[model samples]
Target: MDVSRTRVLQLIARPDFPEPYERLAGGSVWLAEDVERWITEHQPWKADQEAEEEP
Candidate 1:
C-alpha cells in the first residue's frame, strides 16, 4: 500500500486484475482480501512487498 495512486490505477486497469467489489458514488471499491489474493497469485513483486512489510 506504499504505492502511488497512479500505480494503483495502473493495476486496476490490468485485464487480469480483479474487478471492484462495488461501485460507489464517487468511484469503485474492492475488498482487501480479494486484492491480496490476486496479488499473491499474479504479481511477481508480491513476495518482495511482503518482505518489505516485515519488521
Candidate 2:
C-alpha cells in the first residue's frame, strides 16, 4: 500500500478492488478495515512495510 497516489488511482480503478463505500465531494471513501484486508490478502509486499516499521 506504500505506493504513489497515481498507483492508488490505478489500483482502485481495477475491477477486483473494492468499490468505494461512499463518494464525497472531496473523494471516494473506502472502509479502513476493507482496504487493510485487501492489502494483506493481495499485496503481500505490505508485510515488508510492516517489518520495517516495527521497533
Candidate No. with top TM-score: 1
What ranges in model 1 sit over 4 Å off?
A: 51-55
Please provide, for model 1 over 1-55, each residue's C-alpha lDDT reduced to its tens digit, 9 standing for 90 to 100.
5899999899999998899999999999999888888888898598678869889
Q: How displaced is residue 5 in candidate 2, in Å?
A: 1.8
lDDT of all predictions: 0.88, 0.84
TM-score of candidate 2 relative to the true fold: 0.75
lDDT of 2 at 24: 100
- Looking at model 2, residue 54 earns an lDDT score of 83
Consecutive 10-residue window with the lowest summed lDDT within model 1: 42-51
RMSD of 1: 1.8
How many Å off is the CA of 13 in candidate 1? Answer: 0.5
